[model samples]
Target: MMAHSPGDTAFLPSLPQLLIDDAVRAALREDLGRAGDITTNATIAEDAKATAILSSREMGTVCGTGFARAAFALIDPALKFEALVRDGEKVSPGEKLARVTGNARAILSAERVALNYMMHLSGIATYTARFVDLVNETKARVCDTRKTIPGMRAFAKYAVKCGGGANHRFGLDDAILIKDNHIAVAGGVTNAIEAARAYAGHLVKIEIEVDGLAQFEEALAAKADVILLDNMGPELLEKAVGINAGRAILEASGGIGFDTIKAVAQTGVDYISTSKITMAAPTLDIGLDIEIA
Candidate 1:
């Protein structure tokens, strides 16, 4: 069973088991390739059994224990995988998060892929946690954009939620977000919103992205459900907030970082979206140590 953290229950939904299993299977297949752990197959006896501990080398939030277990199971169905902690739980250095016991060859072969998922997902969670902490006192909520890795979108966004950030659109089809190019093609903000309304169902909300106050006013006049304030500095954001006067949900996007997020949050926007948390977060340091008996 997957562990759930109380802090993440609101933002993180239950992920589909089939999807996670398929992803892990693909990753294991990729690693196994043609030869398939030749070193392990040659060095270890086929019947040899061993135990391994997956431990964090640094402090961070955990987000991919399920994926790690799936990887081991895919490698060898009989492998015993125990998750010591659930996804979204925080951990410190020297903390053992999971234990795997199985055929020595299976354990060795699955180690790298399992560690890769856990470390990368945990890193995203940790990075997002910093932003969430910085803006905890503010009315604004932190969220992630569609700028996620191609196949890893589900896992990456899951980690973001684990770190206390919300998710924007799951995909392009999920909502109507009128970006700069959409505006340019549609002739203006109002036109884009109108066209989107006609193109989408009534349930689809119109979120128009504006580069400055001029477009902000147009989007506001058009009554957008959500307005994305793109690349606006603190001054402009403050002015935009004032002009908005609670007219719509304002989202601060574009190039936001740790140093600027607090100031952005202070501007009183409804949501702050950043791609750095998912795109560039450094992998958390985690390792697997094996013991053969």
Candidate 2:
């Protein structure tokens, strides 16, 4: 079997610092492939100087300003980038995010790459904030799912944190989350639960995802420390919470959306995770504008 990549916690991943550096480097490489800003070379004179202002085109929680600056630095170390708004700061349309000034061509060249990271990361932050707000009054906290862009998990997860949602896990190796498939392969929930309890070391907690009350009951009976009540409706989830009775923590997941999340949160699950928080969230509409100075 092909090995799964690094830092995947079975539940959810926390950002590992080393991996963050790697992601930033890789993203810069993609933006600055061979040929190095041909458009800038052809038009803007080398000695010319200009300033640019990064601004928002829509309301959002700002994020990745440092990374965006780092992206420009990688392109040209002499570049001067200043942040007008810190990551996690809320900004409305037309608000200034940052200022950049250096070699005109270099600034022009680094524009797209820097803006790409800023916009993409801010999008995740923006959506995460919404979900977090939706469930703020309830006991449950908003969490991001494994449904993240491949190779951009850390960036997305970071934005989620910036927006006030907690991360689930980074990759499979970090945690032991036994879902429905594992139960089927192991013969039953009890069997899977037993296997996990028997095999995992003392520090590892066992979590299982179950689709219905029967499976949940089996998980509860088997003593799973964390029970993922997948796709269970509000009424069923309340029963699940009652059944857990302060034993296992319950997470309500599967097909959750903005319309239904508040209701799900009211069901008493300890947490609610959804892909809609990241996947398909529109870019927060930030842009970099040249300010000739």
Candidate 3:
């Protein structure tokens, strides 16, 4: 079994501190508002100190502990934040993930924002882990799509990595992915591949999406670096693999779910990209329980 300790980012590269701080501050702002945790301020003594336990209510792969810590730091610089489990570690129900000791009001104020990051990101990691585990024996690897929350792409993709999945292009500018629309606009699959290859330079690898064998052949003939096999059933995908013969990197995508992913993986595609890992992951049940000491 692998262990993830506090600040252990070995599963994936940590997101920039600036980005994490900005996001944490924004969440704190929204949570605090103009009144600033009115309930805590009204009921809790300003000078009171307390301890809060970050615990999991269900089994999941832990993530975003650092982000949660940042939330507390933004709320009160004096708060003592400690992570018991590292990111990417599988946790069981009732597990104590971390602890924060500091100003009671600050702890109460940071509770929601902290738990929100842990729960949401852990959900993505857990869900992606399921998909990754299913296809572990296959030649294909699970990957995440670009369908992520507007401001949380980096965080969501990081969770995917924690779950043992690979990441596709982080953004449109990161790589050239010519999809159906790009093909239609360019008049054909071959044209789209050709145009992408011409525009993208050696630094970029052009991947084109093809819905069927004809377009697959066209893209192959155009010497695309990678090919996306979109929405094709196992039979078609196997045929595509047979025809492809390793000429380019084959990615199976579109409507992939737990029920169909195994079959899709057996087709010998190099990658399986899905939106569910990021866009549809269910947030894990986690909470912060504060106890004054």
Q: What is the C-alpha lDDT of each candidate?
A: 0.89, 0.82, 0.89
lDDT of 1 at 116: 93
- Clash pairs for candidate 1: none
Preferred candidate (lDDT higher): 1 or 2: 1
Q: What is the full ranking by TM-score, best candidate first? A: 3, 1, 2
242-265: candidate 1 lDDT, tens digit per residue: 999999999999999999999999
Task: Please give the lDDT score at residue 223 for candidate 2.
Answer: 93
Reference-based lDDT, residue 233, model 1: 97
Off by over 4 Å in 3: 1-11
TM-score of each model, paired residue for residue: 0.94, 0.91, 0.95
The alpha-carbon deviation from the true structure for residue 231 of candidate 3, after best TM-score superposition, in angstroms, is: 0.6
1-293 in candidate 2: lDDT tens per residue? 11111222344323555665566677767767887778889898989888999999998888878777877777788989998987777888999999988888878887887888889888888888777778777888788878898888878888887777777877887668998789989999999999988999988889899999899999999999888989889999998888788898889998988899999999888888888878977888988888854
Global fold similarity of model 3 (TM-score): 0.95
